[model samples]
Target chain A: MTGQVRTVDGRVAGRRGQATRQKLLDCLSEMLSSSPYRDVKVIDVARKAGTSPATFYQYFPDVEGAVLDIAEEMAKEGAGLTDLVAGRSWVGKAGWATSEELVDGFLDFWRRHDAILRVVDLGAAEGDKRFYKIRMRILNSVTNSLTDSVKELQAKGKVDKDISPAAMAGSLVAMLAAVASHQKGFTTWGVKQSELRPNLAQLVHLGITGKKPTK
Target chain B: MTGQVRTVDGRVAGRRGQATRQKLLDCLSEMLSSSPYRDVKVIDVARKAGTSPATFYQYFPDVEGAVLDIAEEMAKEGAGLTDLVAGRSWVGKAGWATSEELVDGFLDFWRRHDAILRVVDLGAAEGDKRFYKIRMRILNSVTNSLTDSVKELQAKGKVDKDISPAAMAGSLVAMLAAVASHQKGFTTWGVKQSELRPNLAQLVHLGITGKKPTK
Candidate 1:
């Protein structure tokens, strides 16, 4: 098990303290969804949490620190996305199903976590190592698994020798993520959700197997 | 031709005024490159431009307005991205060349304007229609041309019938944009620039043509 949660002042947080800390984090998260990340103030989060600013500082050093806490939890959950591709077959009908399901699961995960994910994206683009680490943790989980799949296919001579599995996997995963983040943009372009998933699935399958899906 | 450039207070900017305005925008752009968006204040931008905050205000209403001005100018140039895919043949060696050049050009464009593009992306993801429109202007230039290519290929029985041209084109373009924005991320993943370009070209060719490149 992980060690006990601690306050910023170096004191270990008990059950009650941990509960209060969680409450603050949740409030900060809600604020992030509604306001710009730069505008999210610690006192406002504390006020929304029905606690004093001092109580908040006891848990998090600042608004950014609290966001990192929430992102950490999300990354832990994101690591589970490895299931979408790991051990999945990439041939014929099975390949199509795997691709479709990976698209569905990846997009759903992005939608559920878009708010904090946006902040993490911005922070990463701004060259913050902490945010870059978090973004990498999430993308790396899926990309690494997909890379292994490609390498396996290559070893069996089922895939081209010239393809860099890491680049292919990373690009495909990045596409899924970029598409997921901008799903709304597609809708505005008159492309519905139903049309999107299949096309995305097709690209994913083609990128992996280098052949059209049997479906 | 576009209308004469005007300051926020209803005065058409003269030559010297236009020069000053451009200097402030250039300084603001530099500031965005080095500082977080939220932390960027008007005073800071003015100081960097060697002007007072009042002079900054005379030309633009606020920092966001200035950013919008910069984005607007960039969008006009970005519209030319259409040339990358418009009327490009996706057959045989020509298709591979088209894909490689598009990837190269797209990545280079993204790198040159990354700082402003990051803010535009964040604003669009935050649901700002102004930023959304600018982004759409750029992506649609490519996506529309690509969608037409897919549809033409499908009509000639060169591509599959099940493909949604718009969705396919949009997803592929989104992948390009995402990969372009995060090019540095790929390097950190141990994928070299040389490795990335060919792989991205392969995926683009595969997605558009529904077959592996002959290369």
Candidate 2:
């Protein structure tokens, strides 16, 4: 009975630790929303989280590590929808259903997290090598999804069978990435998101359907 | 005749100054190709150009200025291509022909300047706002070209009536920028230019044609 109480106590402590860590991350995200990623410091993050420097250190080695953790979390959230479609078979109704759902879901996902997506997009442009790795991981996730969709389309005779799946997959991923980057830069160029979204959706639809809309 | 000789001498001196500046930019590009942009120093660029630091300073205020000059040169090259395509109508036969020619020509241009492209691409990501501005300038050139194409298409009733030409132009420009960024990361990911070029072309084609090719 004593041993059981010790295990329960340990579980509660772990949960509390996790809660603290998450609170810190949430504070960091809030801070980053209004400032450039490079300008934010560890002290700022710690103070904002209502935690001591020592507690911040206990959770993250440095500000970059914390930012990287947030970046990875954002990447995972954006890539999760794609991963779901990548694991499915590439033929029949299940495959088609998955492909359409994933594509539509990804569009919505990018729109929802446009701010964090802007951060990650700009972060990938950093001269650091790790940014490239993070970017490639994100691209790979999108690539896997595109590959599954392309293969399924080809199998169903919906897409050009002559085009290589890998090439099509790469193209789709590239297109989506471009759309995301443009969304990030819209404000600077005096563009509204409402004005950009329909064009982006039209481009995606054009890529898959192969039919140019008649006026 | 004596006045003509003096004028010729002045022209010769001006030409020599221009050549020296070009040589410095060439040297900087070479140095950046083998190293990160942030790692490059003014002394290294001077030594490579076979000039003194004072001479380098005469032309550029700092390393960032020199980088910006090189980026401007690239933007001019990209813009020159658009100027070449501006007079042609982008409808029916001319539309398909102009796009194919442009894509093929661009692929060849990127292939020839892969080293310089890599340096510019890296520099843009290295937190140099000037480099980023230059990249934006390049994209604007592409945007202008697409805008002209869309205008021509709309005049002929070839494009969708609902989509604004400006939005379509933005999307095409974004797509190209994405392709360029992905191509820049290719070597770091063990992907080759030969493997990426065709995919990039297909992506451009997809964006322009609004048709997925049937195998």
Candidate 3:
């Protein structure tokens, strides 16, 4: 036991720990991309990670916990854009930008984190109670950023004041989900990325401005 | 073989066919209410329907096909409402007698079809291509109905002409989906049904009228 511990100590411990975590996440991501979250087990993830089940448990309590970690990490990466938006005036800096930027950014996020998004969607829909709570936390963070933008627009009289920011926030989040859902169906419908961004921008613009741009 | 065929024909061909279909759908409804769609298998559905796996194929080709049939049937039943709306102006008989009536009808739809809605949400997230098509069809139908209403309202000078009817229509559909998704998370968030209708109505009014309600 001491020898085994010594072998995993010092620089090797730190290096191996980081490598193991990345390997696990990568394996989980690959599996979740092709399979349903509920169908993927810890043992499967462990095997895919090139580690034993005991080694897998050393990091996550269970498969869901690992997924939650993946979700949190993805959320953190996506959170950067939200923070950037937060630092600016919604009406002047964010709202005035072309709808393409918004749509493109959103699509990019989905594309970059498609695997984690798949797991998050699955966890939210079918995972246990804890996973759902984590899902809400992610949603709330995203919604808060949107609500802030809406609030800024309302303050500048650019948006309708009569509407509730919370509801609008909900609508925005749902629209994003709808877009993601559409993207998931893109291959089947023979829709290409070239067509997706424009259509999505139109949809988002319509939702936000309540007016369709004459293209 | 002829006797078996005759028995199947006599008992499972006409009214029996309908009964078997209903039984299968009912079993699916029950199973889906408690579990996610992906988790529900054809065998489980057949067993719950009190039939063998072979018999399950008689009515539907697969689980997705069966659920799609059920959704189509529900959509058909709801089709009458759309047709009635199509034949009249927003203030006419088919358009909602009162605000409460409108809210009640919407809530009733959710409550009645909670199981199907769950299936839709589950299937929508899955990489299943058919699920998105089904969702798009529902959205298109609702959008058409809403567009008619928007056109009437615009003609009456009640709705802003600048806002495109199609955009508003998409928002309305997205709103309904948001409300349903919110309700799905109700247990974890402790959301009440009483709060649902008013919020939904307010959002609808905002999207359609482009103005805040007096309430």
TM-score to true structure, per model? 0.97, 0.67, 0.68
Off by over 4 Å in 3: A1-21, A34-66, A90-94, A98-104, A146-164, A183-215, B1-21, B41-62, B81-107, B125-127, B148-168, B186-199, B205-215
Task: Give the DockQ ranking, best first.
Answer: 1, 2, 3
* Residue pairs that clash (backbone atoms under 3 angstroms), model 2: A160-B215
DockQ of each: 0.79, 0.24, 0.21
* Model 1 TM: 0.97
| Candidate 3's TM-score | 0.68
lDDT of each: 0.92, 0.61, 0.62
Candidate 3's displacement at residue A212, Å, is 12
Alpha carbon lDDT at A181, candidate 3? 52
Model 1's CAPRI class is medium
Per-residue lDDT of model 2, residues B99-175, tens digit only:
55665665556555555554454344433466566666766666777777676666777655666566767766666
Highest-scoring model, DockQ: 1
Q: Name the runs in model 2 displaced over 4 angstroms.
A: A1-74, A83-130, A184-191, A212-215, B1-23, B47-58, B89-95, B110-133, B184-206, B209-215
Better of 1 and 2 by lDDT: 1
lDDT tens digits, residue span B1-215, model 1: 98999998898999999999999999999999999887899999999999999999999988989999999999999999999999888988999999999999899989999989999998888888999999999888989999999999999999989899999999988898888888887888699999999999999999989988875
